[model samples]
Every structure is written in structure tokens, then in C-alpha cells.
Target: MVALDGPSGTGKTTVARKLADRLSAGYLDTGAMYRMVTLAVLRAGIDPADAAAVAGLADGVDLEIGTSPQRPGFRLGGEDVSAEIRGPEVTKAVSPVSAVPHVRELLVARQRRIIAEVLGEVGGIVVEGRDIGTVVVPDSPLKVFLTASADVRAARRSSQDTAAGRQSTVADARESVERRDRLDSSRTASPLRAAEDAVPVDTSELSIDQVIVALCELASHRGLLAGCSAEAAR
Candidate 1:
């Protein structure tokens, strides 16, 4: 398994997908899973701070996340909710829902099981999230912690929202990103910290392709891929 841990707007999801494709491995966006749980909590009219209630909801819901990079499906209770989980509502609610201790415990277990299943069936899997390296998969041989300047991340996020017609300003995006960083890092449950052995990549000045190449090199250096370093050089 490969663990890619990073905060929002750092291109964790995109990079994880590309890495999976490059390595011919399965991909899992743990963030999307959290978003789906947040969506369920909101739809059920449960308070975001109600940890016990949210945990119960998370435990009760059945999530099926696809590992295909080209067709990653996020389903909740057997319903396809890929688009719904990425909307503004779930975006705002996910931090608190993910902060809940029991919720993380339940989802982390599910994530581990999925990783094991994918490893058995597909040989490898790349899983991305804030706490994947530190909490979910500490033993993953290749753990990457991606980072970018706050300004760069905010601009990137604003551009994404613009493309999606979300009407977000750069200033607002910066605030949201900062807020999420604070919440994710301060949360008592599996807080967002890079594992001690994780390779850190500062992506503030790099393009998505460049970051992917760096990660590919790291994997190659660690002997995860036989010729990934040469492929990255090319």
C-alpha cells in the first residue's frame, strides 16, 4: 500500500489517482468517504458536533468506494453519491464529521480492510487522506506528505470552484482552506500529521505532473517499482 497524506487543495486526490494509474494500482480517496459520511449526517438533520450521533450514522451507513482511477464511484447506502458529496454543503460539514473520534475509528477500519482486500486482489493500492500515513496505514512502505503554500492552495482551490461553477472567491477559498487546516490538525482523532518516515514534497511551485513525478521517484527509490525512476526521468 502507498499512503498519500495531505491537506485539502494540495492535489492529494488528483495525485493519488495519477499515481494509481502510473503504478497500475487501486486508488482510494479517504476524503470522499468522509464527505459521504458528512452528507449523510447533514441529510439526517444531525448536528455536526454531536459526535455520538454522527458516529452512529457513520456506523449504520454502508459506503462502497470504487478503486478504479478512471471510474471512482462513491456510494452511500447503495446510492451513487459521487457528485453530491463534493458539493458546497458536504464540503462545509466534512471537517467536523471527520473530527469525530468514533467516526474516524469506524472509517479507518473500513479503509484498512479495503486496502487489504485490494492488495490481495490487485497487488497494490494508493490511499489518500489527511491521516492515511499517520493513522490509517503507518506501515505503508511509501508514505508521501504533500504540501503547498497557503496562497497557492487557495488559488488552486478557487480555480477548481470556478470551473465547477461554485462561485467561490480566492479570499473565501483561503479562509476555508485555513479553517480546514486548523480543524484537521487540531482534531484529537487521528489528526493530520505526516508520519515520521513519510517523504515530504513541497508542491507550492510545482505543477501536478511534477509532483506526480517526484512521488513516482520516491516510490522508485524505495523499490516499489522496478523502473519508475527512469520513467520519471523520461
Candidate 2:
């Protein structure tokens, strides 16, 4: 398994999907699991700041996540909620839900099981999340901590909102990213941090293709690729 750990707006999701495609491996976005839980909490009218309530709700919610990079689907309570989980309310609530110790424990176990399934079926998998390397898969042979400057990340988020026909200023985006960073990094349970053995990749000045090429090269150097020529050349 390839563990890609990073904070929000760092392109972890996009980079992980492309890397999985290049390696012909399955992709797991653990963050989506947390987001699904957040959506469920909102629907149930639970207070996001109430750790006990959120943890209790998360314990019973049924979550299904697709490993295929080309068709990643997220379901909560047997309902397809891939798009719903990405809405503003869910995004706002995910940090608190993720902060709950029991919630993280529950989701981390589920993530590991999903990883095993992907490994058995595809022979390899790339998993991305805030704590994947540190807590979820610390033994992963290849651990990458993708990072970028706050300004760059905020700008990217603004661009994304614009593309989606939402008006978001860079200033607001920056504040949001910073606030999330503080919450995630300070959380007591499985905080956002790079593992000791992880290789930090700064993507502040890199393009999507550049980051992918670099990651492929790193994977090749670590002898994780079946054939570097065929995989990296793509």
C-alpha cells in the first residue's frame, strides 16, 4: 500500500487518483469516510461539536466506498451520497466529526479492511488521508506527505469553487484552510502530521502532471513498481 497523508486542499485526492491509475492500483480516500459520517450527522440533526453524540452516530452508520479510481462512489446508510458529502455543510462539519476519538477509531478500522480487499484484488493500493501514514498504515513501505503553501492551497480551492460555479474569494478560502489546519493539527486523536519515515513532497510550485511524475519516480526508486519503464512512461 502507498500511504499518502496530507492536510486539506493539498491535492491529495487528485494526486492519489492519478497515481493509482498510473500504478494500476486501487485508490481509497479515507477522508471521504469522515465526510460521509459528517453528512449522516447533519441529516440526523446531531450537534457537530458534541463528540459523544457524533461518535455514537458514527458507530451505527453504514458506509460503503468504492476503490476504483475511475469510479469512486461513497454511500452512507445504503444511500448514494457521493455528491452530498461534498456540500458546504458537510465540509464544515467534517473536522469536528473527525476530531472525535471513537469516530476516527471506527473509520480507521474500516479503512484497513477496505485496503486489504483492494490489495487482494488489485495487488496494490494508494490510500490518502490526514492520518493514513501515521495511524492507519504506518507500516506502508512507501509513505508520502504531500504539502503546499497555504496561499497556494487556498488559491487552488478558490479556483475549484469557481469551476463549480460557486463564488469564493481567496481570502475566505485562506481563512478556511488555516482554520482547518489548526483544528486538524491540534486534534488529540490521530492528528494531521507526517510520519517519521515519510518523504515530504512540496507541491507549491508543481503542476498536477509534475507531481504525478515525481511520485511515480519515487515509487519506482523504492522498487514498488512492477515495471518502471511501462508505468512511469505513462
Candidate 3:
């Protein structure tokens, strides 16, 4: 397993997918699990602040995750709301809802199963999120802590979340990312943190491709990608 933990940007999602492609491994979008739980609680008409209700909602709902593009499943209460869970409202509130102990336990178990299934095959998985390296898969073969300045991360967030070429104001994006950073770090359960042995990759001054090259080199040097295929020559 390759645990790619990072803040909002730093290209963790894109880089993890590309790394998985190069190594012929699977990719786990762990953030989506949190979003799924948030969406479920909201749709169930349960107040997110009520921990017991949320826990019951979590138990009652089923989260099925598949990586296939056409039918990526994040079903809740027998309804598929994969796309809805990724929208702006859930995006902003997920951290708070996910911070709850019961919710994190539920989602973390699911995440472990997701990674375990991929491990059953010869191909490993590249798991990406805020806490993957520190908590979700602490024993992953290769752990990377990707980071960049908050300004850079917020700029990237604005670009991706906006429609067309327009974006939320830079300040708006910065505040959003900062709030998430604070909440992620302050949370009691599986907080976002770099694992003790993780290699920190600061991408504030690096291009996406440059970061990819660096990670690929690290992977090879660590022998994680020694016999891998599906890569294009650098």
C-alpha cells in the first residue's frame, strides 16, 4: 500500500491516481468515505450534532464503494448519492461531522476493507487523504506526506471548485482550506498528521509533474515499484 496523506491540495488525489496507474495498483479516495457519511446523516434527517442519532444513521445506512467510473457507488439508505455527497455543502460540513468518534470508526472500518480487498490481488493500492499515513493505513509499505503552503493549496482549491474559469475569491478559498486544516488537526479521532516515518514532500515550489517524478523515484528507490508495469517512460 502507498499512503498519500496531504492537506487540501498538494495534488494528493491526482498524484495518487497517477501513481496507482504507473504502479498498476488500485486507488482509494478516502475523503469520499467521510463525504459519504456526512451525506448520509444529512439525508437521513438526523441532526449532525447528535452523536447517537448519527451513529444510528451510520449503522442503518450502507456504504458501497466501487472505483468503476460509470457506477462509483457510495450508497446510503439504499439510495446512491455518490455525486451529491461531493457537492459544496457536504464538502464544507464533512469535516465537522466526520470528527465524531462513531462516524470515524464506521468510515475507517470501511476504508480498511476497501484497502484490504485491493491487497488481496498482486497489485497494491495508493490511498489518499488527510490521515491515511498516520491512521487509516499506518503500515502501508510506502508513506508520503505531501504538503504545500496554504496559499498554494487554496489557489488550487479555488481553481478546481469553480465553474468555467471563474473561482471563489482567493480569500474565500483560503479561509475554507484553513478551517479544514484546523478542524482536521484538532479532531480527536484519527487527526490529519504525517506518520512518524513518512517522507514529507513539500510541493509549494514544485509542479505536479515534478512532484510525480519525485514520488516515482522514491517508490523505485524503496523497491515498491520494482516490478510494476503500466508506466510511461519519464
Candidate 4:
């Protein structure tokens, strides 16, 4: 399996999706898993800090990522939650909930199972999240740890938040990005960092296409490219 780990606004989701499409491999968005769980915790009126309650809440919910030839989407308990999970409300609260050990354990277990399923069916998967490479699937053959300068990532976040109408000014989105960066990098449970075996890429000055090209090349080098007919490679 392939594991791409990185923090928010670093383009982990987009890059993983594109790489999966290119290789004809299944994709899993683990961040969506965390966001869905956080939404559940919030909707249930349970504090994220309550580890037992969060773990219990996770038990009663079924979280899985849906995949196809085009890309992957989020499904929580058989409901398509792709759109709802990306709202400003969920984004604002996901980090704290995601940092909790119970929440991470729940999501990581689900993530590993999904990866295993995809691997059994298709030989591998492209799974992206903060802890995918290091903690979720440490033995993955292809491990990528994506990164970008803080300012560039902040700009990306500002653009996304602006398009979503979550912020009026780029500055506001940048601030949100900074705050999230701190929380993600400092969290105790599977904090965002490169795994010892990861291939690090600084995308601060690179285009989306460039980043995907690098990841695709790296995957090919590692013999993780799927659906690569010999004649086609020739």
C-alpha cells in the first residue's frame, strides 16, 4: 500500500487522489474520516476531550471511504457525507477532536481496515492522512510525506476558505491555517511529521501538477504503480 501523510492545506488529499487515478489504484481520504467523526462528536454534544465518550461514540458509527475509478468520497454509516464533512464547522473542530487519542485510535483502526480491504482487492491503495505513513500503515512500500512552506500553505488555505465563503479576507484564512498548523504539529496523538522512510517533497513553490508528477514518479520507482500493462510502459 501507499501512504501519504501530511497536515491540512498541504494538498495531501488532492495529490493522493490524482496519484491514485493515474495508477488505477483505489484511494482513501483518511482526513474525511476524522472530519466525519468530529462532526459526530459535535452533533452528539459530547466534548472531544472525553476520551471514553468519544471512543464510545466511534463504536456506534460506521466510517468508510467510498472509491471508484474517478476518485473517492466519504461515507459515514452508509450516508454520503462528502459535502457535509467539509463545512467550516467541521473544519474548525476537527483538529482538536482528531488530536484526542480515542478519536485517532478509532479513525486509525478504520483506516487500516479500509487499506487492507483495498490492498486485498487491488493489490494496494493510496491512503492519505496525518498519520498514515508513520502510524496507520508503517510497512507501506510507498510512503510519501508532503510538505510546503507555511506561507504557501496558508495561501492555499486562504483561497479554499475564501471560495467556501468561510472567510472574507485572505488574511483571515491565513490565520486559521497558522492556528491549525500549530495544533496539528503539536498534537500528542500521531502528530504531523515525516516517517523515517517517507519521501519528502516541499511543494511550497511547486504547482499541483508538479507535485503529482513527483509523487507518481516516486510510486513508479517503488514498483507501486497499479494497472501498468507492460506494453503501455514500453
Residues 1-234 of candidate 4 have per-residue lDDT tens digits of 678888677898777787777677788887888888988888899887777887788778777678653747677778888888988778888888888787788778777777788878987678888887789989889888888877777788878767766664667767777788788889998988889989989888888777877776776677766333331232
TM-score for candidate 4: 0.89
Would you estimate the TM-scores of all the predictions? Answer: 0.97, 0.97, 0.90, 0.89
Return model 2's CA RMSD, one decimal.
1.2
Alpha-carbon RMSD, each predicted model = 1.1, 1.2, 2.5, 2.8
Error of 2 at 96 (Å): 0.8
The Cα error of candidate 3 at residue 230, in Å, is: 11
Candidate 1, 28-110: lDDT as tens digits: 99999899899999999999889889988887888889989878899898999998898888888899999998888888999
**CA lDDT of every candidate:** 0.89, 0.89, 0.79, 0.79
Which 10-residue window of candidate 3 scores lowest in summed lDDT?
225-234
Q: Give the alpha carbon lDDT tens digit for every residue of 1-234 in model 3.
A: 788998887888777777777776777788887788888778777777787888777776667676532334666657777668767778787887888898888778888987888878646888888888778888877899999998999888888777534458778889988998898899898888889999999999988777777787778778877744224345
**Ten-residue stretch with the least lDDT total in model 1:** 225-234
Model 1 sits at a Cα RMSD from the real structure of 1.1
* C-alpha positional error of residue 32 in candidate 3 after TM-score superposition, expressed in Å: 0.1
- What's the lDDT of the predicted structure labeled candidate 3? 0.79
Q: Write the per-residue lDDT of candidate 2 for residues 93-173, one digit (tens) a residue.
A: 899899999999899899999999889988999999999889998899999999999999999988887887778899988
Q: What is the alpha-carbon lDDT for the whole of candidate 1? A: 0.89
